[model samples]
Target: MDDEVRELNLTIDLCLRIGEVLLSSGAGAADVTATMQSVAHHLGLRRPDTDVTFTGLSMSYQRSPEEPPIVLLRQVKQRDIDYDILTRVDHLVRDVLAGRLDLFLARSQMATIVSVPRSRRRWAITLGWGVMCAAVAFFLGGNVVVAGTAFLAAAAIDRLQLLMSRRRLPTFYLQVAGGFVATLFAVGVASTDLPADPSLVVTANIIMLLAGIGFMGAIQDALTGFYVTSGARIIEAMMATAGIIAGVSGGLSVGALFGVSVGRFDPGRMLDVEGLAIVVVGSAVAAAAFAFSSYAPRRSLAPIALIASGATAIHALVIAQDIGRTWAAGLAAFFVGLVAYAVAGRVRVPPLVVAVSAIVPLLPGLSIYRGLSLLADGGSGTSMGLLAMITAASVAIALASGVILGEYVAQPLKKEARRLEDRLAGPRLVGPLRAKGRPR
Candidate 1:
């Protein structure tokens, strides 16, 4: 009995540790809970009750009705976007479930994954962000000069945010600072005789800042019935977005005082064939660059790029038919969801990495910025600003819901049918849908 209790304790601890990594790295609550359950069951603790929240995770197990339940809790203190760590831990979970790794080996591997310092150079990540924003410029039909300016602006934002992060600043303030720097840079460029559009530079950097917000995970959690976690995520995303608005508003105020206008953006402009091709290439480059900045595995980069390109093409083509932008975004996100699972399997990374990175190029940064700009202008523009903000929110919801729906359709039909039979089951983005030895 004593030995059994000790083993149970260790098993639950391991499960909680795994859950912590998954949750902190932006996995949905459903995925985190399912992965934890799988780990505990495979390690001989069947029927362990796992609870996942935005801030923490806990698991409990009882050997018999009369015995007191043993429980363990792990707090997720930091939320970092490290796809490499997520991919490594995901493979570890698969190996353990497949019986290729025993409890001891699995635990040891998790330890090393959590303890080892990342070898990726900070400067390289900064450079990747720069390139990503540059690609966003091209996607928005900006010229080479605009792309170069966006590159410099993004590099500056990244370095500033990095320094602020080291000082333990909150993420909201970091976003504000990033927005301010991006806008100020664009204003400076507008003041010069440069032929490039400063608006595109600001818009591109806005996209870069918005890319990190977990709209997809938030919607996934909500759809999966983890309302508490979903609400928390939504609040965080909104706060970060608000910070961007405040910072950009401040920069615009400064620009106005200096008689420099950042100009308005027309998102409704239709693209020709050559322009469409540039958008596709830009989307691919942006996705790959974002993956690299987030420390995604190199093996997964090409797959992510291809998926993003295809999705962008779909979105562009759909929008050309006079369909709403929200619908276009949803269609694109659906493609991402449909293809990401198979691509992730081939690349051996979590589908979340591919899905999130692929959707970076589709984030509604332009709408958000345009909304804020109009609101800043006030008067009749206030209504238009509110409308733009509404459109941005709608696009975000569509993107998240569309991706999850695609995952639902793409999951193996047999397993999905069984899961659907259960009233509580949700789509899996980061774990095996069924436990080992469970009937298919």
Candidate 2:
């Protein structure tokens, strides 16, 4: 009985680990069942030798060779399942763990349910990204210190405001004030000129923020077959683009009162690899800090370092090649998802932790920065150099979108692996199904 208990505990542990991995890899019930059976055999646990039946989440054993099979029509607790429920559970777990989740609501809803370590790490990651944004602003030729402070401050403040909204500022006011606060850093600190022209830095900041939101929403919605949602997200993106115009127009108009002029952006200046590496370190730190802010698990961060840096390098190379990274991203994400699934067969860490982390390097941060900046700068994006910004933004969106779509396709199979694990822990009939001299 003690041995049985130990085996039972191992089985549950294995189930959880496998489930987490399969869910991230986008596996379905079959994958879960298969993964479970494999784990059980390896752990030397009692498992059904015959085929298992799965109704999405629950599972029950079929007749087998051992003793007469129990004619139990019991609902599989963790065994049988609905694909939708499983997927939802997987997503909730994955996003929340990675610090990519929108945690303000989660924290409000489940403050009692969270651990301290998880929460702190998410916060740390968020602040770290703020630093990265600062680094990126410098590369865009903003005064480095000013850009750095502005980026970090804006991110930190926004996160803090979001956390403290219980004090009751209207969202509109909040956004407006948030906009003021965030943009102030760009204008006051970065000394980035607003030119009484279009595309002032403030306008640029608002637009970029909106675009990032829209881009992420669109990708997620589209992948989930939420075409309406995707359409809405795209529309929001467009609206944000318009907002960029408005903000820049307003700032530029204000600047015009001073008879000041806007300047052209020259992309010819580049960051060397060494400098870019430093930037990546900042990006990873930012992501990790953001993760902690979101209340994600502390243990989940090391993967971010590996995945983000590698992704950044690949992204840099892709940019240098002037090749389309959209399709490339899709292909890359697909393979990553698929291979991660395979790896879960052995090691049961959810791929989402690493997959998302690894790909953070490829996010469309720069495109967002440039497009909004162009809108703020106004006039023809031509001549004074908005074209390049527009193009870079386009490419960034495509890459981000492609990565999202690819990951969507891969999440289902991952769930299947988890279902398999749950289905295996049941009674069987007659003789154990003979394997090819191997445990089934």
Candidate 3:
């Protein structure tokens, strides 16, 4: 009984974590709502028969087996506010009413989080994938160093581009602005006669970095069984991905006007070990860049970054050896699942946040770009695009599934703890000690 209550509480915490991750990841309200619904469903919080509909920013829930049920409107920027508060109230009420005061005090306790301003301990706390990419590029291959450096510089340019974009600028205008800056930066490097291969690598990586911008939200929506919401998420993801293609295509075309032709990519070059490793590092870097782009709490990046670096190394190793991306993805997803679960359990944090953060490196942003560009240019391998699509889907699915799996692993232990508490709490007291009304 006590364990069940704690799990409910865990669900609430997970909800807020989902919101923060989404917000920091640049997710829209639809993403946030879908994530909250998924968290709620996983915890079994909603009534089995309830009809719950989520708008991107708010929600309408109707609890009923009724022919007609009343709508309960909740319009909050964050989704899980009431759920968390009520979980606390639920535990307290249940304990007092059921004569189970001892339940909460047992081993496996819950704690509240205080969101205080902390120092920016970037390395100590913010171990994200970007730095991992830097290390891989720095150590494994000289060409990669340039690619990593250019990508970082391009990301900086993209951030500045957002300032011009904030006034509700035309989508093309904003994208072109960002892409142009990135392209120009690479062009300047090209003026020094930088090698075509590394320059192309960096340019291509930048282009792919922008794919699946709202994957977490979209996948969360789908998992929560909100097909409509998930479809919207998919469309949004597609639009962003298309924008990436346009930005890259436009920038490449414009750069060639100044004699900086974005070099033609050669698929044969990617078969080498260094190439494969850099790809994995690039994956981790994408995740880091996403969080950095979103202005997440500066302190919480190190461990995540470290995890990314390690995950990428494994991913790269497998792929370079002609092993499938799926095996590597599963390996990466398992560590991610464990970290997300353990951290959430220990610190009252949310698994969704960690899941989103960790999986950024694994998204198939590059594959999507290469696939689409190939199609546009009348190249073969139509299946490459499909592979990229599946790669992105599989990674998200792996992440969500892994986290859910970890939670299932956690439930029974919590349940046992709760049962022990209930046993210790003894039976309920009868009125007047049962024998003689109040005279006993």
- In model 2, the number of clashes is 71
Q: Order the candidate numbers by lDDT, best to worst.
A: 1, 3, 2
Encode model 2's per-residue lDDT on 1-440: one tens digit a residue: 47654445434443444344342223333334444454444344346342322212322233246634332222332211122233233444344344454333323323333221322343554565465445444433455454555466557555755664556653334444545455444444334443221112342234224422335435544543445535644664555454444444454444446554333333323334546665456445544433333333445555545444555555445545655545444444444444433342233244433444344434443444445456555688533336545554565466445444444454335554333222222110001111111244
Candidate 2: deviation at residue 161, Å?
A: 4.1
lDDT of 3: 0.45
lDDT of 1 by residue, 1-440 (tens): 58888888889998998888888888898888878877787888777788888998899998899988998888888756898888889999999998999888999999999888764898999999999999999889898999999999999999999899899999999999989999998899999998988888889999999999989889998998999999999999999998888888888889999999998788865255558888899999999999999999999999999999999999888888888889999999999999898788789898899999999999998998899889888999999999999999999999999998888888755443455422244667887766432222
Name the TM-score of candidate 3. 0.59
Q: Which ten residues in a row have the lowest lDDT in candidate 1?
A: 414-423
TM-scores, all models, native as reference = 0.96, 0.53, 0.59
Best by TM-score: 1
Error of 2 at 34 (Å): 19
The regions of model 2 sitting more than 4 angstroms off are 1-118, 121-129, 138-144, 159-180, 190-217, 236-249, 259-265, 268-276, 324-365, 372-393, 405-440
Q: Lowest-lDDT window of 10 residues in candidate 2?
A: 426-435
